[model samples]
Target: MISIELFAIGLVLKGPEIPWWLLALVIATGQIGGKLLHYYAARGSIRLPPFLRRKSANERTGRWREYLEKFRANCHRRPVWTGAVLLISAASSLPPFAAVAVIAGWAKVPLVTFLVTGFVGRFVRFGALAIAPGIVIGWL
Candidate 1:
């Protein structure tokens, strides 16, 4: 997510000109829409770009595949944990939500779980950001 740009927009829209929830909803919608594309690509429902595909059977690609396999196995074993991680990533961007989106897709997380968690988390995140400027200014 473009944190700086969102925060700046929140600052500009700090007053009653626009509701914070509306701004949050719009941003969350866009973020989840893009992430859904990534999820589908990883699920093989959508084609991946050439750069994302393996061009050669190199050591790096091999290692990455192995790592992904392990991750996939873990996801299958502990789906709730995986969903929790996705929620956290969406909310705080602690581990980068884009990477998590790919992982969730590859791991075959249920579409409902992905959409619900991602949307709720993103809504919370952007809503807080949208209101932050107003709150801070009120304290001043």
Candidate 2:
């Protein structure tokens, strides 16, 4: 399968065709791969630059730690809704997927939940995008 640009062109102009399911699969896989990479990077950033990992309770890092703890607590309180929003954001590309992934990682979302949500969201998003051109053409 080709890129999003080419896929869009194919949808709009009726260019070369691959089954819609295959295109959706490829796009979803690519999206999830990028998302996972972003998540891991955010997780790893906690240890980055020793200066930012201070142990002092009064330091800036300590404040960051407190904020993360509160966020984690919120996540625990509304795990299902949080995950649903994350999935919807990923699928719709709203509020930016990278930002959401980083937040999820920083909040320590379960790996399985993150992966599953990301995959489902990405698949649905790409599938909808793939069909959008046809819908517009029909309306026109």
Candidate 3:
């Protein structure tokens, strides 16, 4: 159960331990969660189930889709690297997290591109604590 949660959470939450396998598991969950959210949102005025749509459209995810369009526009201006950075930055955006990763994957971003950049960002975020205990402890 924890592994599953870890995987789901890892897509957004920064943490340590929680094996790669667990992260992968959470990634799957996150993807499913996002797809479900998009499905419900686009389905009608329903726009996500009660538990999912926390903020008003003018406030949160309504803005998220707009941002995604902008990001894609920028991607067209450059290339995959542009998306990688945009996506990497988005890791910190949504509270439900994994909004970008799952969305990107759902957008059918090449598996290799998403994994390389997403994992790189995830690990960099993870490294601050997940690996560099000596640095973190020294700060403490």
TM-score of each: 0.84, 0.74, 0.41
TM-score comparison, 1 vs 2, better candidate: 1
Error of 1 at 119 (Å): 0.6
TM-score of 1: 0.84
lDDT of each: 0.84, 0.77, 0.49
lDDT of 1 by residue, 71-124 (tens): 889888998888898899999988888888988898898898899999998898
Worst 10 residues of 1 by lDDT: 4-13
Off by over 4 Å in 3: 1-70, 90-97, 131-133
How many residue pairs clash in model 3? Answer: 2
Residue 60 lDDT, candidate 1, scale 0-100: 45
Candidate 1 yields a Cα-based lDDT of 0.84
- Candidate numbers, best TM-score first, in rank order: 1, 2, 3
* Model 1 spans > 4 angstroms off: 1-15, 57-62
Task: Give candidate 2 regions above 4 Å deviation.
Answer: 1-16, 45-68
- Quote the positional error of residue 110 for candidate 2 in Å: 0.3
For model 2, which pairs clash? none
